[model samples]
Target: MSSQWSQGEIYESYVGRWSRLVAAEFVAWLDQPAGLRWLDVGCGTGALTTAVLTQAEPSAVVGVDPSEGFVGFARGAVADERARFEVLPAAELSTDAVGGAVDVVVAGLVLNFIPDRPDALRRMREIGRTVGVYVWDYAEGMQLMRYFWEAAADVVPDDRERDEGRTFPFCNPAGLEGLFAEAGFSDIETRAIVVPTVFESFDAYWTPFLGGQGPGPAYLRSLHPNTQTAIRHLVESRLPANPDGSIELTARAWAARGTS
Candidate 1:
């Protein structure tokens, strides 16, 4: 079976560190009871899984991801006895493998990467004890990529064509609510969580993409060296100039719950 788009190293590199902050905020919003069993789908380096284990004080936490590298890193990083990592895709989760119903299923910034998201939601509902799930992605109009693309547009008009290459499946709020409803979840709620992604300099912002960890990296790789240099220069000039030199990007997500 093909892995989800998030399995690629490019997407992972850009979002990996930031994922910890995202998970922490999500856990804080949940305020769920302690000792509940939790499942982390597309767990990536298990950032959200670790956050759930620590904040929710869950009885146990199991994190699954399609990337072996991510699973390996997660296993090495999160050593709590209650937490475990597995190399599995979100679509493959089942009651038998999880050993019955889970109290909550969490997928942080992962839904958009899955092509068959509705099916994945169905699987999550089937495995969840109490249908509590958190899903978030880049909001369409407010995406951080807007800054990057703006810079690219100045240097290369064709960049816009490439930018529209793939549709971000979860960029719309109504689409998210509808997906959950179709999956049989009730009491759905959506909220915006903003995190300030501060970069010390242009290098600080651009270096992560060099690692080929996300869409930014992919876009960067597609450009010629001269074009890439021009894009960076334009981005730096367009950005708010500051001595401290930082950029703030807002992340929005939807949280929904139900009883199975």
Candidate 2:
């Protein structure tokens, strides 16, 4: 629940891979025509922005994120002349900075982290000629955090405080749709995209959290090292015992699209 998104290595290590998978799914939702211009809000590491460029082949692509390290990583990863990266928050996007109307605006797994979600959505709408947004958060009852917490609870059963991490911002599909509607997006449609988060072993599963990238990382960091280790062991033990031995985490993300 820290507002700061300064953990660059953590983000790329823990969440960035899965985030890229979700971004690819989000791009599939777009009816991206040739020569479309795209603005990627909160384009962490430029994964989604790169996806947009690959899929849409837009006339120009601009990616913005609040984290300098993430923006820097994105700049280095994506070297297309038409693609640009900036260290700016989504809430600051305006018609003035963008020059003229943008053909499309895309946000990937970003809305939940922004403090002023409504205003940010509105700004995206204002700047976009057409808006397509994708958000992936811990779905209620199906959260990956639940796996960690179920194990952590054994160690710290009294800590009801840790639950708030699971409940942060866009934890449900209805909430996501409502935010879009409130922001004046019309013809909003939402659907669930399920991805299997497979890990080779407990170390593969738990190392990412130690990096402290997103909510899971944050929660892991809050614990003592002993408690963190215990939680990891517990989660590994609870994994469905497959002969192939890959831990499969069912991750659900909500994607919404509408006209500005």
Candidate 3:
């Protein structure tokens, strides 16, 4: 049980906000036909599931997550009978649960977190005729969190190596496309999706880190309160702010899709 799968609301506050922005672009690039059956692996709050429903006409959608809290929230929030949520692991998906395979399978902000991505991707391919994935380009393309880590390095030089950006190098296109290839997918296509993450104030931007939703926020929780404050100060000192006290930043995610 990692904190990453703990609370859906806390995660929505941290990265879900930006994931929604990316989901639209991610589904747009999916470019699949309407009336397709979709399986949203690691759906997490139904952001991607909602994106698919909103952007395209899907006959049915099944969302799976190991987190019960997330599944519960998704079931309650997404009102369509066409969309359903289940507490299931990516590695354990089967034809029975997915209704004998879907037309397309998509995972959002999830690939980098899978313990065994090759196995998970293979399962995804098994559950759908098309398999796809997208993750925040934490290594380079996701600038907002990267900037936070950049400031963090100044405050706690000793902990710089553990930053999310440094640790998740597979967030890039090459890594993702390669995973799809390894999973026996063909016609693979990968693209970068960039979106803006704006905050009304610095506090608005930084408070999510206190939610303990992901590794970065979990790392923040590990530090002493004084150290956390120092990191916050460093981050604020480094960020460029607008006159109205708002901060506008961009986050990019690498997406890849292919047929099996």
Candidate 4:
């Protein structure tokens, strides 16, 4: 099934919180000097843009996303003089939008969703001296989604075809590196940024899937109500919850960067 990208609040409940953690680590990893112009391609509610403003001290940051709802949410959520939100797609991003060539450009947890990643990366390379991106290691290290999809396959084997792990094979280091290299970037590098994803209870975790904001959740919504409950129960049973019933999982994102 095609993924849903609108509905900022629902998407935030699903993965935006986790993406914020990855974005901070990702910005720190880039280690760019302060006072530079930055572009956040597929900014998605300003997670990475906020990180850049708070961590990197960029002079200015323009966040661009295809979803008007996401851009609106970002504008309201990130109220910084240095930050601006635009309703634009990654494929259409240009230096003009960011007010000339930017010093750094980054995409957080969004490369996998772009239909033409190579072209997008090429465009990113053109707009910034340094370009970086991070995507969830959905195939393995992103434990939360891994658990959900594993349980899903057990209940409905055909659903395995819809798993992000299977769908986003290029999210890994080698694949990311290849994309950067092909985009004519130099000194390419990649690393994993794993963070804690703690839910107060199974309800906190299960409820987000019901919001139907992304692929996994959208897929879950497609099933019969009974099947959805079965998947939820199977995932809950498998989770190693704490004595207080909190569920702790780690999300790992593969981050890559290169110089233009």
Task: List TM-score per model, in order.
Answer: 0.87, 0.90, 0.96, 0.97
- Which model, 2 or 4, shows the larger TM-score? 4
Query: What tens-digit string does per-residue lDDT give for candidate 1 at 143-250?
Result: 455667767767887556545223564545577778887887777766666566666676777776566445566778777899888888887777664766665555
Mind giving the per-residue lDDT tens digits that candidate 2 earns over 1-260? Answer: 13545655667666677777877777877767879888998888888988888877799998888888888888888989999988788767997776567889988778777888889889999998777666665535345666776777787787645653445656466787888899999888888777777788767777776776566667678889898878788887887746877677776777887786
CA lDDT of each candidate?
A: 0.70, 0.76, 0.86, 0.90
Which residue pairs clash in candidate 1? Answer: 9-213, 10-212, 10-213, 10-214, 11-213, 11-214
Alpha-carbon shift of residue 1 in model 4 (angstroms): 14
**Candidate with maximal TM-score:** 4
lDDT of 3 by residue, 1-24 (tens): 243666778888888878998999
Candidate 2 collision pairs: none
Clashing pairs in 3: none
lDDT of candidate 1 vs native? 0.70
Error (Å) of candidate 1 at residue 143 is 5.4
Query: Which number leads on lDDT?
Result: 4
